[model samples]
Target: MKKIILGIILLFNFSLVAQNPILDIHTADFANIENAYYKDIDNFYNQFVGTWIYTDSVKIIRFKFVKKEMFYRQSIKSCYVDYLVGEMQYVENGVEKINSLINLNINHSEIYNYNLYSYGKTNKDWYPKCLECPDTIERLPMSYNEPTNDDAGLEAAFVMHRADENGVEKIKIQYIETIGAYGIKPDGSPSITTNFTIPYGDYILIKEN
Candidate 1:
């Protein structure tokens, strides 16, 4: 009997394609590999899974992330990718804002329609806050997009840890929303910058004990 092994190695130096964990793509350099199965090999996406809450006098929000794996991607090339699907409960200034916690299931094939989508973690040498006091820390990168608003898409850059010195898991996110530049708008104009109802800003969220 003869064994037949095949590999589909595609060299894409110009454009990124078939990257695992496509939400944030764990790899620093795009690999020309076979089968578009962007698996979370390092398990970086696991830390973001669970319920996180941030509260203050005027703002309160509870966010949850669920892992969606082996999801087929059709935006560019057809491939299975991994992503952290997010849902949230938001309120500001004593007024109820957005609450989609009731719809926190991870059965949706389309990741872009969710409140947040993230995959993998990365550490920056320039912004290494804790050089001496702790374990490995990495940032969770995600994007926020409200399904109804086409113009509202923001990049969520979050720095997270499983626990602190006091053993409290925390995550810090930037207050300002970084708009994603996919391309120009449908009318051939620039992409519009927009904010969300969720006071998604500079916040330190603590995981539920």
Candidate 2:
């Protein structure tokens, strides 16, 4: 009728500019993916400042990280994703609230030696898989354990420095408790303490040599 009503108003302005996530930059969808996901989470906490340790049977905590910040996504369309949150102001209740809940999601692969490792999708319920496990969105030599007998359990106990089988410098000690079977010891061997009532969740990933 009049060029079909100007081609239906230019297809409704291209579907409202492809559902506006900051005018859709080729498809990050939402004002430049929350500033490219917090500039890769401030370069992954400035390469995780330094020091981190977590163990259990009662306690052992050391996380002395200093810099981390990102929390800007008030309603850029509200699909609920806009954070790079950090700044634990040093420990208070252990591992600075589990390393600010180790929530990362930006790993645009490039054979990284840590080139902004992990790109998108690591928000594993934000604490409470015993506080983020399977080391959610993993990369750097990740590890996890849980199994103190609902099917078998033991949760954790590590001291790896492997080489054995002939290269020998070995010093292994893995006893991940309670998600299933787990046991391995050789750090001066002879250990046996198994008991699990179930309610486990473990996480590990270390490679900062």
Candidate 3:
């Protein structure tokens, strides 16, 4: 009896995709600073500052006075948050949210305060705040064979999250009327009746507790 053993070696030649060396260097720089911030307690002084705005039909406004907080060089990309006291304000009208406070479709003053936390670097301006911004609103742009502003189309979209001290991560909900309910949260606001009901242009960033 002859015993013959056949050994096959399977080699996977990984094609090394040559990426730009400068890209790695840039990433490393940000990453190194981020790591240091996480480890140091004193580094938790910066606030995760962002903007919030709202609109009805007549007026479009921005939190023009939103303050910019100091961010540690090491905290550029880390998931760290430092609690700093802050407040937010807005104007409302005869809407359900603010009708009791005042009447008429005129803008009124409103404010909310919260502790600061850090998220990753966000775009300086998510949606430019322009009162004259066109009504180019759509969850997804209509293409060749897609529905565009039919009766059955996506309505209001909202991003919700709790801006806590440790870090902002409790909930993030986008309300599309086409999907479900059409009322504001318990905290007195307009019942997001329809997609169009949401003021165009101004992005609403709800900072949770």
Candidate 4:
């Protein structure tokens, strides 16, 4: 009877562990520091280091500056001067869940150029999804051609679309990207933009702890 009870307890513990498997977030290995451009673009990169909440949806995004590293593939080497990591989370059915993760690589010379990578869990395993993907969104200084009534100095525009069996529609999310210098107005005033800018409407986000 004692042996049977011990076996049952061990089996129950194993079952519990199997049901809730641990996920490894740090599975990505970093290459040697090829080039560091954080010093050059520190001002631009610093603006993204914070927790941003989306008011339209239950989504929250946080960005933090990471180390500069070089990635190589197919004998091609590209240096990421200012590396920023972002995590996205949302609530579903009253349960908060991580939707996806992203790593951004910014060029030192072209502050607007950004290389993005999607990192998250796939089939219960963490993997880096897009590496040097062609689809990229850039932050450009507000051009005189694209005028806005709002007093914004910069703007980031990306053209995207959603496709279904019905067809597709051209969509562009152009809005006030950043405000002030280093996220503050020139006159020492505080101005912030919405987290997610969509064609349908602009949504506001609150900072999360």
lDDT against the true structure, per candidate, is: 0.61, 0.31, 0.27, 0.32
Better of 1 and 4 by lDDT: 1
Q: Flag regions of model 3 displaced more than 4 Å.
A: 1-57, 64-88, 92-118, 122-209
Deviation in Å, model 1, residue 73 alpha carbon? 1.2
| Residue-wise C-alpha lDDT for candidate 3, range 24-45, written one tens digit per residue | 2112343443323222233222
lDDT per residue as tens, model 4, 42-69: 2333333444554334434322223333
Query: For model 4, what is the C-alpha lDDT against the true structure?
Result: 0.32
Q: After superposition, how far is residue 106 of candidate 2 from its true place, in Å?
A: 26
Q: Which stretch of 10 consecutive residues in model 2 shows the poorest summed lDDT?
A: 109-118
Q: Flag the better candidate by lDDT, 2 or 3.
A: 2
Q: What TM-score, computed on C-alpha atoms, does each candidate reach?
A: 0.66, 0.21, 0.23, 0.30
lDDT for 40 (candidate 4): 20
Question: Across residues 1-209, which tens digit of lDDT does each residue of candidate 1 receive?
Answer: 12222222234422345343343257733223333667677777887788989998888888888888777666545666777778777778887777886666646667666777774566533132334323455666666655334442344344344444377787665544455544445466665545556654466789973
TM-score of 3: 0.23
**Which has the higher TM-score value, candidate number 1 or candidate number 4?**
1
Backbone clash count for every predicted candidate, in the order shown:
3, 27, 0, 3
**Would you give me the overall lDDT of model 1?**
0.61
